[model samples]
Target: MKLLYLSYLNSFKGLSREVWWLALVTLINRAGTMVIPFLSLYLTQDRGFSLEDVGTIMSCFGLGSLAGTWLGGKLTDRIGYYKVMVWSLFLTGVLFIWLQMLESFYAICSGIFVLMVIADSFRPATYVAMSAYSKHENKTRSVTLIRLAINLGFSAGPAIGGVIIASVGYFGLFWIDGVTCLLAALLLLLVLNPKKAKELDQVKNEAPRSAYSDYPYLLFIGAMVLLGLIFVQYFSTVPLFYSEMRSLSEVGIGLLLAMNGFIIFVFEMPLIKYLETSTLSRTSLMIIGLAMTTFSFFFLTIGTWTGLLVIGMILMTLGEMITFPFSSAFAMDRSRSGRQGEYMALYNIAFSISHIFAHNGGMVSIANFGYKSTWYLAMIIGVMGILLLYALRYRLQTSRKK
Candidate 1:
């Protein structure tokens, strides 16, 4: 038991100080991520918006995210990542507070769109920073550490968000979310002194390629979009499932969602560390991950037992644990020396596009066919993604041999 504990602790060794600081920044920012998880519910219950209206509003969030990531990528490539990160964090914090003042449907839609645009721009810049800070061998683990912070924050955020909503109302959510973003921004500026780390601004000597021109990468992005559509249901639809189907309360739903984060927080880093030693290609591991994620939806179809929720959440979390960090590392490795920002932007943008579909499509399907049918559709999508990934694997191997 002692040895086992030590080995798990050992997994965090050798990461650079900057990576740790970056994780701290991510942790603070994500810790207040109370708004998005509860956005659908807040719209329907608090604002009295129809499900269809909620879908439109959420789609706007996606569209804004798409624009933000693309802009962030270009800005990072041009102005450098430090300025991009700081500005994105600070501006997003202000917008989160300002978003609460909008009352009408169209106003809220526009607010959510602008808020997400500033908020999500932080993603690719952070990825570029991680690349700059981490040693080559530590890249995946570094990404995992960042993800661990994210999930750790997520684990706390929703549970706390539920309590906050119950106590202070949805209005309070915006304030807390806004404050945290500002805090995270300040922490980044104070701690990650870009002046000391001039390498962040250093030009890569290797030739740069446009991510748009990379064919295999485009296919990989497509597969991720499919995977993302399935995965994002947790944020958009699964909460409703707990409330309407299982009759769980807000707190109950929060705890259930937090369960996903807790499992990942505990298990993911160790899992990634172990996988780092394996001979299996990253694509093979991704296929395995996708299979688990697909089966999570399949688990939902089997029974209405609340136990199935826990089971499905576990499977989904595990699948993400395996899939995300390796995929990030894979994307980073695929990026040319100077174009990491563009490559990572497209990678994050794939999820943004998925958000556009996942919320609207999942909600519309539930309204029309019911939740069970939606799960079936998600499973089918997951299967198609798995096959696409398999094809990607074959193509990558053929290229290597050639």
Candidate 2:
């Protein structure tokens, strides 16, 4: 046990202090992530909107994400990531506080769309900052560390958010989320300086390349979109599954979701550290992760047993731990010095597209066919993602031989 504890500490040994600060910022921001997870339920139960209306509002979220990420990337390349992140966080906080006031369906949809535009712009900027802060050898682990922070925050967020919702209603969640965002922005201001980030960036010079023109990278992005389409169900639809199909309370559903975050928080870093030393390629590991994610749906289809939910979440979390950090490392490595923001932005946009489809698609599937059918559909998408990853691996191998 002593040796194991030491090894776990060793995993974090080589990272820079800036990376730790970035993780802290992410943790603070994500800790208040209450609204999105419960938005569908709030719209339907509290606001009396139809599932179709909920789907449309969520699609608006996707569209805003697409625009936000693209704009963030462009600005990061031109101005730098620090300014983009600061402004995004501050503006997002202000918008969230205002978001709870809208009563009409169209007003809610428009408000959400604009709010996501300001909020999601932080994503690509954050990725560029990671590249600035991290050394090349530890890049994947660095990404994993940030993910660990996110999961740790998520683990607490839902459990705490569940209680907040129960006591003060959904609007209270908005207030907390807004305040946290403001706090995160302030913390970021105190910690990371843009001039220092430029000094820390290792890649000094390289030819510029357009992410849109990179065919192999675009193929990889496509596979990510498919995987994301399935993965995002946990946030957007799966809670509803726990509430409606399984008859779980809000707290019960929150705990179930929190289980995913807890597993990732405890296990992901050590697992990634071990995987980093292994001989298996990143693509190969991702294929295995995708396979695990596919089977998570299979578990759900087997029965209504609550134990199956736990089992499925464990598998899904393990898969996410394997796939996401490596995927991020791959995206960063593919980027040239001048265009890192663009490449990562395109990478984020892939998931943004998935958000667009996943929320609306999953809801429509559940509403039209039922929960079991939705799980089956997710399984199919997961399989397709695995196959696409294989194709990408083959093309990459062919290019390397040349």
Candidate 3:
């Protein structure tokens, strides 16, 4: 037990204090992530929204994410990461309070759109700050640390949210979520202090570089969008499966969802660290990750038992553990010094695209075609992602030789 515990500490050792603090910020921000994970359920059960209605509202969030990602990328480069992070965090929390009061479909949808725009704009700046603070060798691990904190918070959020809904209902979820967003921003302000952000290891001489012009990077982003389409099914459609098909209760579904985060928390860091000494190229690692992702849905398609659900969750999470952090690290490596934020923002746009596909397409598909059909789509998309990511290896290799 002591040996195991000591290894975990050794993994985190040597990353800067700023990196750890950033991870704390991620933890605080995600712990209140109650609104989205439970959104379909809240809309369907409480507000009596049809799947289509929920889909449309989510599409609004996706639209806002697209707009916000672009705007955030531009702003991160122009305004510096500190100001962008501060305002994005503060205003996003304020918007959530506004969102809680609105009732009409259009009103709520509009509110969600604006809220996502403000909230997601923080992402590029956050990436910029991470790149600024992280060392070259530890870049992927830095992203992983933040992801670890996020998953830990996610593990806690739904467990608590299940209670919040059982007692005070969805209203409590929103209020608490808003407070936590504010709390995360406050931590960033108190610890980093916007004025002293310059003390971080920023790229001192950055020439302007356009990410769009990089064809290899563009192809990589395209591959990620397809991968995300497969992945976001866990968020948008899987809950519906456990509810409608598997007959899991609300709390049961929350635990089922928490399984993803808990698995990542346990296995991902150690696995990444182990791969450091292996001969596999980063792209080879991504290929393996995508292959694992492709098969997870196929395995889920086999049966809906508790054992299968556990298996499916484990495969999907291991797939995510393998893909997301490494992909971000690759994007960071491909970026020109000053252009890292733009690259990360473009990479994140894949997420926005998947949100559109996941909510609008995933919901509508399941509503009409059935859950098995949805998993089939996930399987096919994952296959396509693997092929594209395979092609990406050569591009990256060629770039490396240049």
* Model 3, position 334: C-alpha lDDT score: 74
lDDT of 1 by residue, 200-268 (tens): 323465569888888888888989999999999988898898799889899888788777777777778
What ranges in model 3 sit over 4 Å off?
38-54, 165-173, 194-201, 204-206, 239-256, 303-309, 363-376
TM-score of each: 0.88, 0.88, 0.88
| Residue 76 CA displacement from its true place in model 3, Å | 0.4
Ranking by lDDT: 1, 2, 3
The alpha-carbon lDDT assigned to residue 95 of candidate 3 equals 81
RMSD of 3: 3.0
lDDT per residue, candidate 3, 1-402, as tens digits? 898777776776667777888889888888877777788898889888898998788788789989898788888888878778878888877887777788889997989889888888888888888877877777788889988887788777888899999999998988888888898889899887756643345575446678888887787888899988888788768878878888989998878777776777877887777775588877888888888887888766786577888787788788889888888888877764437668878988888888776666887898899889888888888888888877788877887899
Cα lDDT of all candidates, in order? 0.87, 0.87, 0.81
